[model samples]
Target: MKITTIGLGYIGLPTSIMFATSNHQVLGVDANANVIDTLNNGYIHIEEEGLQKLYNNALKAQNFKASLTPDYSDAFIIAVPTPNNDDAQKSCDLSYVKSAVRSILPYLQAGNLVIIESTIAPRTTEDVISPMIEATGFTIGEDIYLAHCPERVLPGNIAYELVHNPRIIGGVTEACTKAVKELYLTLVKGELIESSASEAELSKLMENTFRDVNIALANELAKIGTDLNINALKVIEMANRHPRVNLHAPGPGVGGHCLAVDPYFVAAASPHLSPLIQTARKINTSMPAFVVNSVERLMASAPNKKITVFGLTYKGNIDDTRESPAKEISLMLQHAGFDVTEYDPHANKNEIMIEQACEDSSLLLVLTDHSEFTTIPETATDRMSRAHILDTKMIVKNCGDNVKLLNLGNMHQSLNKIVQEV
Candidate 1:
C-alpha cells in the first residue's frame, strides 16, 4: 500500500520509516524544505535510538521518499503539532492539523483512509475534520474513512515504543475503525483497542493529565515535607511500598510537550469541571520559581553567586527542549542577578564544556537526570569556587567527599545547617 504521512517531525518520520521498511511505499511530506532535503540525502533531522539505521534500510528498500507536497495514496496520516493557544484558557490549536489535512484534500481519493495522529480536542474528527472533508464532496465514513490515532511514544525510546505500545484507534464509524486497524496491525505488536474518535482524543489527553496531577501531588508533598522537616523522597519511597499506591517523583517542574501542555486542553474544554487539573497545572508551573528560591538558599551557603546548570532537555538523554524547566530555571536565575551557564552533553552544540561551565562557579544545579550527570569529572570540581551541588532529579552519583550533594530528600537538613551557622 502507498501511504502519505504529513509533518515529518519526531513521530511522523519514525512512522513513515516503519511503514517503508515494512514493504509499504511511503511519502513523507513536511513544510520545511531543509527537512525534506535532509531526509532525501539519507540524513534525519531528529535524533532517536536506531532511527538513522532504519531510515537507511528504508532508503535501500526504495520504499520511502519525502517531499514538500502530498501524493495520492491509500492512506494519509496527519501527525502535525497541536500547540496550545495564547489565550487564558490555553486551548489546543488545530491550525497545523487542519492545514495538513487541507493539503491532502486535492490528492485524496475514494476509499482512502485518513488518520489523525496528532493530539487534538474532543469531537475534532466529527466537528472540524468531518465538515472539511464533507465540503470536498465526499462522505466521511462511506467515501473516506477517518480515525483519530494519537501517538504514544517516549522520545529516547520512540522507535521501540512506536511498535510495542498498545494503540487506540477511534473512528467516525465502526467501519472506519476497522479500516485503519488493518494498516496499524502491520507494525503494532500491542493490542489495538477500537472506539469512537472522541473517546480516543480524551483518552490521550487524560493519560498525560493523570501523570501531571500525580506529579503535582508529589511536588506538594515536597513542599509540606520541607515545612515539617521531613524528606519527601523518603516518604514517597515508603508510601509506594503499598501494592496499590504508585507515586511519581517530583522535579524542578514538568516539561515536554505532553505532560506540561495536555492538561490545559482538558481544562479549556471544560473550565468549571476541571478544578483539580487546573490546580495541578498551577502547582507544576510554579515549580521553576520554587527551584529558583531553592537556588538562592543553596547560594546563601556558597561563597559566590556563579551557578552552572547541568542539563536542559525536558528529560534525560534526548535533544528536545520544548517547554523545558531547565530553560525556565536558567532564565529566572539570570533575572535574579546570578551568572548562569548551562551544559548538557546530549544537547546539540552545548554552549560550553562541563569544566569550562564550572570555572569559578559556586553552585552546580542538576536539572535533568542524564546518566552522564551521575558522575562528575574530578577535574570539573577543581575549578569551582565552592563545590556545592543541588540534584533536583535525584540521579547524581560518584562525587568525592569534597563535593556536597543536596536533593529533595535532604534539602531541609541543608537549610537547617545554614540557620545553625547564622
Candidate 2:
C-alpha cells in the first residue's frame, strides 16, 4: 500500500517508518523542509529507542521517503499535533488538521482511506475532518474513506509500542473501519477494536483520563498523609496488597503530552458535565504548587538552603520534558526565593541549570525515578551540606536514619512510621 503520512513529528515519523519497514511505500509529508531532508537521509529528528535502525533500514530499502508537500497516495494518515488552547479548553486547534486535509484534498481520489492517528476530541473526525474533505466534492466512505485511529505509543518506547499496543479504529462507516483495521493489521500485533468515530475518540481520552484521576487520588492522599504526619508511601503499599485496590504513585505533577492535556478536551466539550474528570485535572495540575510548598517548608527548616532537583523529564528513562513536573517544581522553587539546581541524565546539559554531579547542595529532590537517580549512593548524599531528601516517585528505599526523606503517596507514611519506631 502507498501511504502518505502528514506531520512527521514524534507520532508521524515512527508510524511512517514502521509501515515502510513492513514493505509499504510510505511518503512522509511535513511542512518543514529540514525534517523531510533529514528523514530522506535516513536520520530521525526525535529520539526514541531503536528508531534509527528502522529508519536506516527503511531508507536503504527505498520503502520510506519524505516530502515537504502532500502527494497522492492510497491512504492518507493525519498524525499532527492536537494541543489544547490556553483557556485550558480541549480544542482540536484544527488549523493543522484542516491544512492537512486541504492540502490532500487536491490529490485525493476514490478508494482512498483517510485515517486520523492524532489524539483529538470526540466528533472531530465526523464533524470537523470529514466535512473539510467532503468540501472538495469527494464523497466519504464511497469516493474516499475516513476513520479515527488514535496512536497509543509511548515516547521512549514508541518504536516497540507502535507494533505492540492494541489499537482502536473508529470509522465514519463500517466499511471505513474495516479498511483502516486491515491497514493497521499489517504492522500491529495487538487487537483492534472497532467503534464509531466519536466513541473511539472518547476511548482514548478515557484511557488517559483514568490514569490522571488515579494518580490524582494518590497525590491527594499523599497530601492528607503529610498533614497527619504519616508516611504516604508505605500506606499505598499496604493498600495495594488488598488485590482489588490498585493506586498509582504520586509525583511532583502530571507531565508529558497526553495525560496532562487530553482530559481537558473532554471537559471542555462538556463543561459542568464531568465533575470527577475536571477535579482530577485540577489536582494533577496543582501538584507543582504542592511540591513548591513542600520545598519552601524544607527551606524554612534550613535557612538559606541550596536545593538540587534530580530529573527534569516527565517520567523515567526518557528525555522528553513537554510538561515535566520536576522542571516546573524547580522553576517554582527558584521563583520562591530559593536557590535551585537541576540534574537529569537524559536531558541535555543546556536544559538544566546545575552541574551533573550532586555535590555542594543542602538538599536533593528526586522528582523523576530515572534509573541513574535511583542508584545514587550515600556517598553522593554525604557530599551535600544537608542530606534532606524529597523522593517524589519513592524510588529510594533506604538512606539511613539521618536522612530526612519526604516521599509522595500514602504508602510512605507507614514506611516512615516503621523507620521511626525502629
Candidate 3:
C-alpha cells in the first residue's frame, strides 16, 4: 500500500517509518522544512528509542521519502496535534487536523482510505472530518473511506508499543471499518477492535482521563499527608497490599500532552456529568503551587536562597517536555524571588552543568525520576551554603549524611515539630 502521512511529529514520524519499513511506500508530508530535510538526510528530529535505526532501514530500502506536500496514495493518515484552544473551557482545537485534511483533499482519488490517528474529542471524526471530506464532493463510504485509529503508544518505547498495543479501528460506515481493518492488518501485530469513530475517540480520551483522575487521588493524598503529618508513600504502600487497590504515586503534578490535556477534552464535551474529571484536573493543576509552598517551608531559614533543580522532562528518561510541571515550578520559584538553576541530562539543552547548578545552592529539588538521579554526587554538595535535598519522586537516595534529605513523607513531621516548639 502507498501511504501519505501528514504531520511529521512524534507520532507521525514513527508511524510513517513503521509503514515504510513494513514493505509499504510512504511519503511523509510536513509543514516544517527542517523536519523534511532532517528525515531525507538519514536522521530523525524527534527523540524515541530505536527510531533512527528504523528510519535508516526505510531509507536504505527506498520505501520512505519526506516531502513538503502530499502525494497520491492508497491511504492518507493524519497524525497531527489537537491541542487545547485558548478559551475558558480549554476545548479541543481541531485547526491542525482540519488543515491536514484540507491539504490532502486536492489529491484524494476513489477508494482512498482516510484515517485520523490524531487524538480528538468525541464525534469529531463523524461531525467535523466527515463534513470536510464530503465537501470534496466524494461519497465517504462508496467513493472514499474514513476511520479514526488513534495511536496507543508510549513516547520512549513507541516502536515496540506501536506493534504490540491493541488498536481501536473506528470507521464511519461498516464498510469503512472493514476497509480500514484490511490496511492496518498488514502492519499492526496486535488485534484491531472494530467500532464507530466516536467510540474510538472517546475511548482514547478516557484511557488517559482514567490515569489523570487516579493521579489526582494520589496528589490529594499527598496534600492531606502534609497537613496531618502522615507519610503518603507509606500509606500508598500499605493500601496497595489489598487485593483490589493500585494507587498511582504522587508527584509534583501531572504533565505531558496526553494525561494533562485529554481530560479537558472530555470535560468540555460533557461539562455537567464530568464533576470528578473536572475536580481531578483542578487537584493536579494545583500541585505545582503545592510544591512551591513545600520548597518555601523547607528553605525558610537557609543562609542563601539559591536553589538547584534536577530534571525538566515530564516523566523520566525522555526529552519530551510538552506540558511538564517542573517547568511551571521553576517559573513559580523564580517569580517568588528565588535564584534557581535547572539541570537535566536528558533534556536537549541545559544552561548549567549539574555541578554548577548545585554550586552555592542552599536547596536541591528533585522532580523527575531519572535513574541517574538515584544518587547525588557528594562533591556537588561540598560547596553548598545549606545542604537540603527535597526529593518529590522519592528516587534520590545516596546524598550522604552531610546533607539533610527530605521527602514528602518527612516534610510534615518537621513542620509539626516547629509548630510545637513555637
In order, the Cα lDDT scores of the candidates are 0.92, 0.83, 0.92
lDDT by residue (346-370, candidate 1, tens digit) is 7756366778989999989999998
**Each prediction's TM-score versus the true structure:** 0.98, 0.92, 0.97
1 or 3, greater by TM-score: 1
By descending lDDT, how would the candidates be arranged? 1, 3, 2
lDDT for 271 (candidate 3): 92
Could you tell me the TM-score of candidate 3? 0.97
Model 2 C-alpha lDDT per residue in residues 1-25, reported as the tens digit of each score = 9999999988999999999999999
Q: Itemize residue pairs with steric clashes in candidate 3.
A: none
Q: Scored by Cα lDDT, where does model 3 land?
A: 0.92
For model 1, the superposed segments whose C-alpha errors exceed 4 Å read 420-422
- Clashes in candidate 3: how many? 0
Q: Which candidate number maximizes TM-score? A: 1
